[model samples]
Target: MNFLDHPFNARAGDIIEVSLDKQANVRLLDEHNFSRFQRGASYRGHAEHARQSPVRLRVPGT
Candidate 1:
């Protein structure tokens, strides 16, 4: 799934986990992963969960 500059399909209560350490990433439904985990200011994730999970994601402003 492309959670960057685009939205993906996920049902309600679908889990969206964001992890950043060695890399920035988004795991949908706790199984599917975003195709790209762009570093710097090129990443994004949902600000909140929803049936329409277009959650906001981004690299911390520097």
Candidate 2:
């Protein structure tokens, strides 16, 4: 399945998760109808704090 096909539904303090099998490919979108995760921003997951950033990745092998 293509990850890009699914729209991002992030927010100011939302902890979003993406699946991966050893490795994964990623892209940084400007601004779509959904929200985004900005680097340096803080988020609370269950009871822990975390940050967010736009990561560009290349999965080894096709």
- Which is the leading candidate under lDDT? 1
Cα displacement (angstroms), candidate 1, residue 40, comes to 21
lDDT per residue as tens, model 2, 1-62: 33444555454544445454444444433243113333434432222122333332222221
Report every candidate's CA lDDT: 0.39, 0.36
Q: Which candidate is the best by TM-score?
A: 2
Q: Which segments of candidate 1 are over 4 A away from where they belong?
A: 1-6, 22-62
lDDT of 1 by residue, 1-62 (tens): 33544455555555444434333344332122233343323334343433332444433221
Each prediction's RMSD to truth:
12.1, 13.6
lDDT of 1: 0.39
